[model samples]
Target: MLDTFQVAKARHTLGLRQAGEAFKHVISESDFNEAYNEIRTWSGYAPTPLLQLPALAQSTNVEKIFYKHEGSRFGLGSFKALGGAYAAANVIREKISTRVGHDISISKITSPEYADLAAKITLVTATDGNHGRSVAWGARRLGSPCRIYIHAEVSSSRAQAMRDLGAEVIRVMGDYDASVAATRREAQAYGWTIVSDTSWTGYIDIPRQVMAGYGVMAREICETMKTPPSHVFLQGGVGGLAAAVAAYFRQAWRDASPHVVVVEPELAPCLFESAENGKATQTKIVTETLMAGLSCGEPSQLAWHILAEEASDFLTIPESLVGPAVRLMARPLAGDTAIEAGESGIAGLAGFVTSALQAKLREKIQITEASRILLIGSEGITDPEIYTNILDEN
Candidate 1:
């Protein structure tokens, strides 16, 4: 099966430091517990599957392969179901509590008692797709008005999905970074609370909450696994998902945690650029890739702080392998479960496969037959039209 695909090259950078106490303030056990406790109480909350791919492992020459499939996550088809919605809930809860002159329980924040207050608080964010849908769904659930901003390349289906969830969808003229800026400006002008997954200077709190929400997924993975994996290849989109999962593994397993490898599309590799420059650097997205959700130009500052300290490696995959990765997952090797993964979801898988096939990159990242690997399947068929097109291609 491995012989069917060509060995794709990847650019890798070793991490700055081992996971430690430094970035705990950004995301901690307490934060994860809080998010888990609240998020688990949601109407449709459940841990997504952790799939074992012995066929993939055998093909890649690894001891084992575990994929945390987020396709069924809250029926949203992406791992982003955790982050944005939970952050939106927090925003609504906090604002309502401030108005009521006392702290309100997250449990009761969505009760009938807070309906009017929630209605007054409009939640806003800019997303490539998944995050905006989560925020919009949360806003609708909590009785808050929501506004979602999308970039020029964001699909009509994704924008309409947010609209279906009651978000007022706005299409910005430029790329994802421009949409993010548009959200900032509009939020300030209209006094809307921004529930962004990515963080900037003064915007750490909500993003922190978002990442903590993501910890529920990590916790679920740990709870389900008999043993921790040796390596985890996480997809990087503003580094929130990678940082959250990496941070959780580091905290949970400490010194024995899996080596974190952040994977991004070569076209929009902000975290890769940041690793190269030794800082939270921004890349200008001159062209977008098929992996739409990972098309982020700027790294989240808070996420970078954690990724810098916790992640062991960073890799950028060329656009050529993304479709193949998706197709492979959908039509897997013998005995492997068929996973309907989206382009963004396949970044980690693409990185892992490429690294496994390329000897130099494999050794550099320390992949061997004895190594157990974990990959986060971050999304599913997020956009049906785009997904169909990819599958239909030769």
Candidate 2:
């Protein structure tokens, strides 16, 4: 059995390997400009609001606290759309170009002549909930098929949402990791290209494309802020979202970038252990947490690399604090500024709060009133019953 230190070392090494490979793409300033411009061209909705959490800031000792509110993302109530849609577009464009022996951008590939090509293309992925929905939405818009493999634990509402978007939803028994395996198997069997955000061996491109899409979020946040926060707390599952933000910030501000902290549930601290050990490692124990989105057992190789290189630290929070963080956000504050954040969405703030409440964390991190913190509310009301009814029960 690998010791904790050994596990972390393994993760760090794996992260380095993946980062070296991802750097090949390099995502130049022009790539970001192209991605942002292309994303605007394929838009279905307005940009999500970036709101200041004045109440939360005042409640905490931190000097500033901001929330990148993705709750309103394309009416899907999650930021997954940014990645999922871009992956679909990338795949569609690639397929069309391969057939016609010429390059076709997302804009040019949507014409009537390519209608048959779109119908033949299918996007496949595995998700706890949000990412799959975003892919399904994109597929529907692009006139393609989508197959979403979801763990059994995912709520009916979420599955139905994907189905509503015309995705063929497959319920896989077991956990999120198992669902990913199931999706991979089906994708291979059917020759359907997988557009997963997580990367394994021989499956790097689509995931990288997905990460590129997520870069839009960081770009938006940086552009919107007058003076970006000194620290950002990002929730981590397989670390795709955290990695995307970290990589973009690493490039956007270079060495002057804010401290990028990846927050994970203590139950599944693969990235945390990976960061500590220096190579990618998987947790032997299965995770059981209210934040389903953060219940990944293994770190994606691509995301692992980005976090290892860019993130300043990894913070692990216990499962119990997830609920309190949700409640705290929902409570009316400063008259009319209550935040209705989902469990996974509030995990970053919860980690911060837990750190503040812990003497060791406070002393070690030097967290003080001068610290400026940023948290991402990645989803809103995904599981309203858990956030609402459970909080009411408490």
Candidate 3:
């Protein structure tokens, strides 16, 4: 598929010295490992696989391509499952300490002894889809009540999943960024604890935990990937997942951090715009796009702190490329198993392939035949109807 969106690009760090300093100041391996250890105790905790796509590599003219398939990151069907739930758990732990007048062990938060304490707290958030489900799932796991606010454009399938998980759902009037605002207002009014993955001023810790939870996925990628990739392309929403991936890789690879490229919807390229402006910037107009998760109109402060300095490139892609990317992942050219990736799930691959195909883009992003590419397959078919429609379209 031909890409209609022009890539907005930048190289933040002058060298490994600057990149390592930026990454160290933001997050560390211990931050991610704490979450990973806690996540290991979850009922369905299992490492998501890092699958090699040689045919994809050959097609893109790269030496190798490794896709960390996160479709089955727990049964929630997206990497968001790792984040919101873990943050909810952490929030509950803090509440538990407040209730008991002392620090409590992390494992005992969900214990039968503290079940009533956990139930006393209510967690809330706004989402396009995956994050809300993960928050609801987290609340469900800790026996806490959850409520989610979503914008008008959110698909019914995603809303229904949240409802199915026993979360109260509210529909707002605008787009995802609007729903986040709505969630903030409603949270303040009701005194509900907002366990969001995105961060703002005076609201960094919970999101820090949330991103740290996502770090588990990054840690797994590093531990499993034998040959470190030359480039790590990640899809950006509020930048939580992308930053987590970038941070871990930056730490693990040390002075040899991969060329990190952040991808987002052209209609909602807040990160791309932020990188270009050299500061966090909000989108003037929020618009519809096929990649719901990437349809945010603002950048997260927490994410910006990590991404602005560490990320080497940023790309905003058109909706037209999404359908073909999904189709490409669904049918592998070689004997590799077909990946059941959704529209948002394939954004990294979409951006990577788009850049690799064009000589200018390849040169601009510093891609060549010797480069080893890594694209995260972020979600599975979370929305069956949209998945089927797009899959059938292309």
Candidate 4:
């Protein structure tokens, strides 16, 4: 299957793995525990599948490949289901606590008794697609109003999904960064709580909560696997998911933690650029790629702190590999079960396959026959129109 598509050597950089205070301050074990405890109580919460791809492993000439399929996560079709919703609930809980002059339990705050109090608060966020839907759904579930800001490129279907969840969907003129700016500015003016996944100066708490929520997925992976994979190729958006998973795996596995690799689209490689500069840096997204969700210009400061300490390598993949990667997951090799992955969801798989097929890159990343690989399939058929077109055209 890989023979049909040409694999290019991905541009890579070695990370400065200096695990220290910066990473520790961003997320703690207590934070992850709180998130897991709350999220597990949700109506349809269940751990997403960790699928073994023997055929893909054989095709790529690796020992094993484990892809975490997050499509069915709370039926939100992405891992964003974990972060955005949980953050929104936390925001509501804080507001209710302040109003009542007491620290309220999550169960008490989210209960029907406080529905009126929850409805009084508003949650806001910016996203290309999945995160906004998660925020909107969370708000609706918790009896709050939600306002989602999306950029011009986000599809109508995605926008409608948020609207269906009772979010006021506002489309910004520029790209994703512009949408983030809009959400921040309007949120401040309206006194709406921003449940953003990406963090900046003084805005770390909500983002920290969001990342902690993502730790639940990592915990699930850690519990199910007998031993850690040799490598984990994580999708790099603003670096929230990557950072959260990296932090959890490092803490859970300790000395035996897998070598972390952050994967991004070449057109929008904020985390990739940050690794090059040895600090969190922003990149201008001059051209958008097919992977809409990963089209981020800025690396979240909070997420970068964790990634800087944990991620051992960063890889930027070309737009060419995205369609093939998505298709490959949908129509798997002889023994592997089919996975419904979206464009951005295939970043890790694409990066891993690209690097593995290239000899120099393979040796640089230390890929061997004994190496077990972990890939995060972050989303599933996020935008049906775009997904259909990609599959149909290819």
Candidate 5:
């Protein structure tokens, strides 16, 4: 286990470096703040309600369960839009600044100007589904050319969604990690800027930007609550979202901050494995789970650093439990109060339910009656056929 002093020291160093790097690239807090404010204004939607799930709370032996539903954001049906668009905008802004020798804000860059700029640049990334769609959307919105590479396992519906958003989609003949490799190689060859969330050596800025964009969600959560959550269960992919939430919450609440639990699918528990190993590591596990979002073979370097220091615990759930949790979420929490949640969204809830280390999890952290618990419903009803099939099977 990492000592508190070490964690604090590391976080301070990382924070300073991240802030400096972000500013140098013109992707400062002001950039994220500006994008978030604009999104709030132009998007005809409010922050999704922080809903209480009494039944879920009871089942998990917690006093309360608060679900932060992201289903309603811009009707895109997922939370990917937040980070995806922010990163895309940052990339465009930087490209413009490099050519014109001055910063160009997203709002001020007209469609024709953006199109001319975008036509000169190519936005590249790999995804299971949501992230690619989000990048495609951002590229289209900025009038940039985009090329998204996805694994063969990605569903037809998701691939079509990227195409609908005007991205040139390619189906890589392997899993998620392989697609990342393929995308990276392609980006290197063609000089396209790769805005991927998963980071490796010599490639960090775009992924860090992605995480910084995700920090807006944490800020929203803090502002929405009177007394913030006592524990936050965040699902881990390449660990971008989990790291973002954990880092921001740790900064915001100091020692009184929530116990953050990073949850992963047992089949591909890359973040959990890295946390246990006390360093960033990768594995060659085949992921055959429905929670495609959590099927990452490796953790992002920036994400690993944050989780290694600050995350309270890491938990992995078996494939068997995911379906049941998805069904349970669809059922009315109390009476006539059903919450719509996708399979990926319910993974955290499943982790809480299946964990044998429940006592250890709570003991290492803190929770009480007044302590709210926040779980992100990251996606909503995206794969209705799969969701319906899971429900019917259950």
Candidate 6:
């Protein structure tokens, strides 16, 4: 099931040098806790289960693999629910406070008294699928208007999901990056506050909130683990999730421990490109792949800042490997439970699987037979038709 991998020279030197002062600007437990407290207020909120895959370990030559299944995170079907929803809520709260020239706590913002006030504000974001659904769902829950812009690459099913949540879904031409750019243009003309997870110069606050919301997952992961894994292969989208989780590990783990490896599709390896360039670099992506969630062409600036030094490596795998990874996760081995990982959801596994096949990479990343691996299945079968079609393949 392995395919060609586009390996980049990793910036492996890592330590806790920035963990105190510089990282303070990135985020902290209090930031994550604030998001977690808000997320727990949701009706059916609970910690997602972390499943072990010993079969995968045997196959990849790793000691063990712990897959954090985010498929059922409040039934939104992705870890994005944490970021998108929390960003939408926080945006409205900030706007409400700004309008009244008074401090507005999140508790009061969630109360029934502010339902009318919440309905008046609008939150906007651009997503491939999961983030859009989460944003729209959050807006609906808070009685606010949410406008989601989807690029041509996004599935109609995903756009419909946002529509189902009462979001004004706008379809734009080109790729996800184009949709993001178009969303910015639309935001300027329409006057909606952008709650994007990706950040720019002036718009770091909402994205910071989004990234902080994602930190709750890391918080949960840390709480569940007595011993940390040797390697963590995280999906690299705009780098929001990777940086959020990496921020936690940077603070939690000791120097040179828990080597963080970011996994992205070779076609759209924004983080990999950025890491190589030593800054936030934009990718000139053309075609789309099944791993739509990580189909970003640019890294988030704030996320890049956190991950540039925190992450030990970056790996890019072929698109062909994604289907196999999904099947591998879906068909559990022995005592392992089946996990329905979507296209992008299985990217880290794909990267790890491909990387583990190569002896040099194993040596370079220090992935020995005793190394424990951790990966986040960031979504479930968000697109059932694609999932079915892929599973139907050999």
Candidate 5 positional error at 387, Å: 1.7
Clashing pairs in 5: none
- TM-score for all predictions? 0.98, 0.90, 0.94, 0.98, 0.87, 0.93
Worst 10 residues of 6 by lDDT: 8-17
Summarize candidate 3's per-residue lDDT along 55-145 as a digit string, tens digits: 7788778999888888898898899999998999889889999999999967777689998888889999999989999999889877899
Residue-by-residue lDDT tens digits, candidate 4, 1-394: 6853335647999987975854456799899999999999999999999999999899888999999999999988899999999998888888899998889876677688889899889999999999999999989987999999999999999999889889999999999999999999998998988999899998999999999999999999999999999999998999999999998987888879898999999999999999999988999999988899999999999899988999999999888888889889888888889888999899999989887888887888999999999998999987889888888875
**How does each model score on lDDT?**
0.90, 0.76, 0.84, 0.90, 0.72, 0.82
Name the TM-score of candidate 6.
0.93
Off by over 4 Å in 5: 1-35, 355-371
Per-candidate alpha-carbon RMSD to the true structure: 1.3, 5.4, 2.8, 1.2, 6.7, 2.9
Q: For model 1, how does the per-residue alpha-carbon lDDT over 148-217 read when each residue is reduced to its tens digit?
A: 9999999999999999999999999999999999999989998989999999998899999999999999
Candidate 3 regions with alpha-carbon error over 4 angstroms: 1-20
Q: Write the per-residue lDDT of candidate 2 for residues 1-394, one digit (tens) a residue.
A: 1011111211111123233423224344655666677776665756677777665666656787878888888888788888888888888888989999999877777688898999999889898888898889878877899999998788887898889999999998888888989988888898998889789887887877777777788888888887767888899999889888877876777666777777888888888888767888898546467787888889989887667677766778776666567777777356325777888797787766666555566555567888888888898887666667757855
Q: What is the overall TM-score of model 3 with all chains considered together?
A: 0.94
Residue 330 alpha-carbon offset, candidate 6, angstroms: 1.0
Q: Candidate 3: give the clashing pairs.
A: none
Cα lDDT for residue 135, candidate 6: 86
